[model samples]
Target chain A: MNNNILEDLELFNEIIKEFLNEEKTTPASKFISPENIMKEIDLKLDKHPLDNEKYKKLLKQLINSTPKSSSKHFFNQLYGGRHSKAVLGDLLAVILNTSMATFKIAGPQVIVEKTILETISNLVGYSNESGGTFPTGGSMSNFMSVVMARDKIDLSINKRGMSKTLIAYTSDCSHYSIAKNASFAGIGRENVRYILSNNRGQIDIISLEKEIKKDIDRGLTPFYLNATAGTTVLGAFDPVKKLVNICKRYKIWLHLDGAFGGSVIFSKNLKNLVEGIENVDSFCFNAHKTLGAPLSTSVLLVKKKKYLYKSFDNDAQYLYQTHNKDY
Target chain B: MNNNILEDLELFNEIIKEFLNEEKTTPASKFISPENIMKEIDLKLDKHPLDNEKYKKLLKQLINSTPKSSSKHFFNQLYGGRHSKAVLGDLLAVILNTSMATFKIAGPQVIVEKTILETISNLVGYSNESGGTFPTGGSMSNFMSVVMARDKIDLSINKRGMSKTLIAYTSDCSHYSIAKNASFAGIGRENVRYILSNNRGQIDIISLEKEIKKDIDRGLTPFYLNATAGTTVLGAFDPVKKLVNICKRYKIWLHLDGAFGGSVIFSKNLKNLVEGIENVDSFCFNAHKTLGAPLSTSVLLVKKKKYLYKSFDNDAQYLYQTHNKDY
Candidate 1:
């Protein structure tokens, strides 16, 4: 390694040592209020680069003030602790810095991603035809599901803008991404029928069916139904098995948002929460949340792989030079 | 630090040392063909965890078989070379692992992101009211621009599905994401008017105007015009200043996709390539490209900050607990 990389690596090791010691003693770092952040630490990006010592000092100070999400005491959201293996994987990924766009560039890294997706598919009881890809995060995975559902219902929607009012059903307890994704997919936020959730925070099957029927009666296309594997607040799992029939009868695509609790599939005792996962048109989960990976590790799986290509496949001559059949 | 962490860190140092040594001797590693990838690397994910020694061995094997994206000889895409400072930043981010959703959780990290956005906005000559956010990648930044443009022209599209035939124009030489983003935004891929590029690969100004006029004559709403800075196949820059009048006349939102070459804003000489960047309604670029940050670092800036919230803001009581006005 060159002198620059060696110096940076030494700085990294020193900082990590300090961080680990702090975590052991305090667990949670001192929280700096948003208003006082500028006074607490120097966060400026100057035209001239800082010297190695100054840069290291500034980085350590900034890190000291920032929230310790990986610490045991930090529990603000759905994700917290960092698995050692996962951290190792992330460090390696940063060092590799490969773009997984094509096989030619990514090589075996593509196989690694594919294997993880396939393993998840198998866990969900999906068929050999099932396949998936890693989106940026839960919101994007939800967005992709909405777009695929729209295209499946009306293939012409991909070619021509929406002419029919496509209605989607989701419980009020579901992730907020559902409504946002609806708007993104051009279905309109108002078109998403927020079904009433039971006291337990699960989607009421009757309410979902009622909303679907009402939309159909209004001559609107009931295209998608989003069921939560684990709701945001109550950590409630929607009745996935019960909604399967409703989706089948109404011809609406069913998607399971396992952003908060989808990692339950990894557990033999808890996999029953998503009992009808195989029957759902699509499913997504954040490994970063329950699997203790780094932030933004989301995977989206489809029952039939063709829908993924149908919705997202766009050709560019320059990017895809390889003519591999598997990819 | 725990024994596990120490062991992993030691292993990481060892692997990185080997990687650097290999990079020096052979800048580009051997390229394994797609068909031979499986035979070359053992990528199976077993149910039980491998022993520490076995795990380290497997990891090294996997790393050896993978492509050396950070090496000097690896130049498959728009990005390469790992800047020591950027690598340090990414490592710190992984350790912190804080989500930038709200001020309470992210704290100074939010300010850091905001500062970068503000600096970029100022560089583009945007006013104090201008702001931006970090999306997942270039494709997503482009997608957000499309959605915002669609909502800006007709706000009702967010509430009611598209009743109007909205048209978008982009150069044929632009990134392939334009058509895909159009489909995602509900404008339909066919609705994207692919204006022919001149012999130099820049968007033909006359053809763009002609398409806009033709669409207007057909009672279609021309909502967005995407100008490219450093197109995919040929590193061509579209005439940003010339398109300003056309977009103004049509009342269309102009977005600059600088995914491949927006870093020129930092160069005194090359800044003239994107001369009228200040007039654009929205602008985006991938820091991972020319800036040499890690993969998937994209920034999207908007001239008017309110339009971001207008298009993407949705409330969830559980996630956004703090009522900070700045966030």
Candidate 2:
């Protein structure tokens, strides 16, 4: 090993020891205000470089001050805890510094990601025609699903700019990303119909079907419907079976925003939460949540592989010259 | 340090040493076929668990076969090299695993990302009104810029699907992501007018203006124009000052696709390449490129902060309860 790496390894060891032992034990550290932490540490970058001793001290300070999301006491965020294996995988990826845009540059790393997506697709009961991608987070995954539905509804939307008042339906209790994703897809926030939820905070199928018919009666297109596997507050799973039926009847593209609770697919007992997930056009879940992976390990699986290409595939000659069909 | 972490650290060091000493010194390793690598190691995940001894050995084999992009001989991709500090930062980020979405959850880490973005924004000569985000990659950054421009042209596009024939312009030699972004923004791929380039691979300003005028005469709304800071093939810098004038006259949103070459903002000698970048509505560049950060450290800056909110902001009550204006 190089001398510099040895020194870094030692320093990192010290930092990790402190983070795990000192920070992880305290609940008060989890609520440290950003302003309060900034007062204690100089985060401001200056013109001159700090000496080795000072740099090490600053790094230690940063590790000390940063919120301890991996700690047992840290529970402010939707994603908590960390897996050593997943962290090792993430660290190796950083050291390799490869982009997953193409197979030529990424090599086996592409297969690693593909394997994970494939496993999740199979768990969701999708067949060989299904595929997925690891978006940055749950929001991007949800947003991409909306884009695919929009394009699928009208292939001309990509060319002509919105010509119709297309409506999207979601449980009023679903994650806020649904409305945000609708906005990103050029489907206005007003157009995203927030159907009334039951006492369980799950989407009321009666309200959803009624709203779909209401939109159709108003001469507007009812194009998309979202079913949440785990809601933000109540952790309720929408009636995917009933929603799938409504989607089939109205020809609306059905999507399951399983970003929070979709990991239930891994459990034989809990898989019933999203029983009709196989019928949905697209499904997404974050491995960071429920499962103990690193944050942002979001997976978006589509029933039809064609939607993945139609939504995101762009021909960049310089980057994708290898163009293998297997990729 | 924990016993498990110490063991894993030792294993990681061995893998890194082998990668640097053996893999980094050769060119053939850079071109290792995916199939060949698969033959050397098992990638498929099975239900059975491997013992610690077997698991560690398998991991070593996997690491040995994986392509080492950090190697000096590997230069097939646009991003090359790795900064030790960046790698260290990324490793720490993985261990902490904090989401960048909100201040409450992210805490001090949010400030770190914000500080980096603020520094880059100032480097591009953006004012107090300027704001930025670290998108997942060059394409998402470019796509976000298109979304901003689309919304700026007509806020109603988000509410009602495409009703206008809005036209966007970019040099024929620009990055492929621009055309893809247009399609994503519901501005059809056919509508993205590819202005002919000069022999130097720079946008022909005359052809651009003529195309803009022609599109206007044909009753198409000329709303957006992208000036490439570095053409993909020839590395040509477009005449930003000239394009800015046409954009101002036509009331079009001017975006600088500096994904490859925007790092020049840090070089006094080469900053002249994008001299008129300050006038553009938005600019993007990847720190993973010339600056040698980890892969996907792309930066996107917009002239006005409202456009960022208009394009992306969606309210989620559970997540953004501490709605701080600083973000």
Candidate 3:
């Protein structure tokens, strides 16, 4: 709005145009040396190190980043394909800066996240009672699924205290996240039993069943099982239907770690991969992955509604309670 | 592009505007029934049972999505703020669908993410060997740090196998995710010893020293000691400088979990809270939290760059090796 700001904007436009022209002549990345690039840029814009807050300094910073995770050059993990539309939604989201913890601040994102979860639920064949939340990613989703399992099967654990002797099961080939989830949720890693896996990376239901029995024989309470839809090392799908049957019979809480492949529901061809998902207590996947959202758009859909509360219901006086005057 | 398309665009624009306007009218914490909200949207969108086809159905979905996370009165977790510019970048990222594993697929994003990492490095005061990556969230960041510690302290453990005698240390007030990380990384929860916390909720350093001595006396391998910054429940900060010294003297890998408070680097007031962060083998934080990036934009910066490969260099021939040729 000021004359100085107007002058700066005009100068900025000219310098940007000059840089674009030079880049068109020789791709910006070709000029490797920081000094050379700086010198070249200086010819277009007035170089004054004294003006530390100038746009050129910021522009220089915008150019020289290494490792380049977003640049297609930095592929270290799964879910690398970034989504522009999803990114836009996230941009809109941050500007809005609303939390999903309540009914109002998260107006549209709440509906969007909820609807997306519902879409996923329909794909997974959950009933009207099924619901979910947009956690940071698949890892957090798995964490929630584990907590839900622990809470449902051992409802008294939170109040009476964790049964240190309790045990849970997942396949050897499944993600290592589940073990961590159990440890964090107060189950202690000692209680989490790893069931052996088949050569194809599927959970050996027989082995899992035997482990549960063995743990019970050892006088440990058996509570939960996490069936992976796809393992990180190998794209492995667990025998979800078979695993669910065993859990149902044994009264263990069953949930699916479908973060990588849960989006397979979108592909009719891949839908069969998660056949027993409908039978599980909960399921989750990353939209940032196969579903094409920005990183962190992960969802956890539950078959039973009450379990989510059992896991994350922090009854702080300032929040969650219905008595807040601001609310 | 066409009159039909134009008409549809107008309808979409009108609908989104109306939705935004209506959103401003809603009261926070009034407890709007999910069913009633869903019904109202259904009335607005008027989904015809007869409509068929995947693409159109997905369009209907876009129309129905909750647009803003903040507008819904949601704030359950730490990193719900969805940034607009970053989201725009993300959408462009998804549409282009570049694999960041290599420069050939994700040239621009790789450049962008690399720059982002560098900015983080400068903040943490790591000049040369400092390195990091954008993992899913705090849990994975913790998981990777554990993996790095395990590989750095004991290489044979990876090739030979995990020893039951190995142990890790964190405060009783630390995030649940840390215990999970230890267990998932194969140390087992039994090996993760929880140190007692003082009244202000800092990790008891004297107790930590005692436990490490006890573990060493018993011939157990004490590999990792995690000092948390911004603990979950109490938002507590550990004494990083002391922990770093102890870790250095005992040859233990020290990690700082600043996933929540790492962004305090930008604040002159809070930066000193993590005074000795540079001495630790690794440190991690989520930009999605304090930096306002969408979920899962977590960065794990390590003191020794080589440790990064030791932890996550598990990429096989098909998925990663081929992409290596691009850069």
Candidate 4:
């Protein structure tokens, strides 16, 4: 046979193998069985993607056989443990992946979101205008508080740029996320101005007032105050009455980080812990924390739905196109 | 009968009806129907400690009637859409509730958090020094990025205050939360510059570079850039490579809000969109968004671990309890 003919036949075999492999193997994998036609990846040194067949199969099998995060009883995190009716909803969401930026795209998810938000808003004794989105956690809920406060000070932050030395206040016992939030707002951690707390870990209102006065004296702007519903450290509640009064006096935005204890709203006896909560601008709780829901179920609600729009009302196309269409 | 005695007895009857209502009912109607006098609540709203007979019945009914979210088809929000496996683990977490802030208090939760974080860090191709925490959502995640950026610019922000003239950039295609985040951090929304994007919705890098320089020339501090992946808009990805270089040149902190798109780290085909992701100073994603996990399953990670500590490292009592002594 001519050398050219032999080379052509070899090329045919290569193409056949390529077709078969491409249809079977994923880009990455790790197989446990020694003889399972896996991709030929060098586990010891080759941590990179390769074209080895045996190695690929082996990797795929390994990954497939790894403990299932959804099925295995490994609920060490703050979210899911044993899903119930909610899992059905979760799977349905996957088959119909959609965003929450609009009502039309999300369809039922939108209704569900609104209903859930309404249920929570009602629990907080908010009026019809009260509403919020499903943030990922308590920390993010707190983050929402800052956003609202910022908006109240200057709507242009969403447009032109910042103009004031905006300030935020939280108890020393507050989550570390608060100071982190302050930094994120470009407020510099120093501007967060921690207020000393009572023995029970609740905010010390006197210190808060003095500090706000000091900031005013120093010409630093003050705009928001965060009150803890149930801080992470000790399940402590701030004296909501005093804080509300101070916020009212200064016309500051009030936010409650009720991630863990917010669900206490469900128990009549426990409701008093968050007394005077209605006076605040916004509140949120982690349904996953005490309500026995899955993880990542933190709800951020405002006394008025308008505040959410005021804080986070950007309308990006594709996600919000349906929301933008005229009637 | 005496007037007081008649009132007490009448009150008792009302309380029983209150506990039996469908809205207030738990355990469930499956065990006992009201027709059979099986379902009931308290006779009074102010009853102390609740009536034992009715309370136990309610508990029993709650445990039984309690619909399982894992089993049903309910997809309202991120947290409730929990998986059964994650739920079981979460229940166990509650039976043995522990915090994950450190190894001592958290033990396994900490390990799990660390493992999950490591897996995510590896997916983003971060170096060994990369670090992060399981935050609440995209908002807090964005906020963390801002905080880290602020501190990196001038740690003095931690003590001084947000520089009112500071400039940060996010796309018009981005989430409204970014602007809110900027507002909350003390830099009023005025400081948040929403750069419009192209037809595909990617941040216009040319405009971004121009703005940074313009801000500097105008005596404004230009320090942070927020690039969205899987934008709330058309699932657009920012020009990460170009932005990373500009950030490098200008010494600005670059944050990639990959809340919806970060999950692509598990998919090779989609991963390239975030190609130059490693160049960003911080990254965040929502597992609940694409991973089919329950809500509140969100995270925030930093390429440089020091940034997390620099911005949020805090000391407190209850959470930082006196080191445990061998009992």
Top-scoring candidate (lDDT): 1
**Candidate 2 structure quality by residue, lDDT tens digits, B125-158:** 8888998888888888888988888889888876
Model 2 chain A worst lDDT window (10 residues)? A1-10
Instruction: Estimate, for each residue in A158-262, the C-alpha lDDT of model 3 and write its tens digit.
Output: 443343455678887777676555544555555677788888988887788888888788877787888888787788999887887898788988888888877
Estimate, for each residue in A117-136, the C-alpha lDDT of model 2 and write its tens digit: 88778878889899888888
Question: In candidate 1, what are the lDDT values of residues A1-327, reduced to their tens digit?
Answer: 233566677788889889888888887678778778788788878988787678778888888877787777877669658787788888888888888878877788888999999988998999999989999899889989999999999888898878888998899988899888988888899998889999999999987787787778888889999999988889999999999999999898999999889889999999998898899999999989988789879999999999999999878877786538675
Residue B170 in candidate 4, Cα distance off native in Å: 5.9
Once model 4 is optimally superposed onto the true structure by TM-score, how far is the C-alpha of residue A216 displaced, in angstroms? 4.1
Better of 1 and 4 by lDDT: 1
DockQ for candidate 4: 0.13
Off by over 4 Å in 2: A1-9, A27-38, B1-6, B27-38
Candidates ranked by DockQ, best first?
A: 1, 2, 4, 3
Q: Note the Cα lDDT for every prediction shown.
A: 0.86, 0.79, 0.64, 0.63
For model 3, residues B1-327, the per-residue Cα lDDT tens digits are 122322432343344445446556752333444556655444232233424244344544433354344343444547444444444334233323344556543544455566667766777888788778877668788888887787677665554334345678999887777655554444656678899999888999999999999999999888899888887667789989989889988999999999887777778899999998878888988877776565447888988787887645543344444333323
Instruction: Order the numbered candidates by lDDT, best leading.
Output: 1, 2, 3, 4
Which rank order by TM-score, best down to worst?
1, 2, 4, 3
- In the order shown, the candidates' DockQ scores are 0.70, 0.54, 0.11, 0.13
Q: What is the lDDT of residue A114 in candidate 4?
A: 62
**Residue B24, candidate 4: alpha-carbon lDDT:** 39
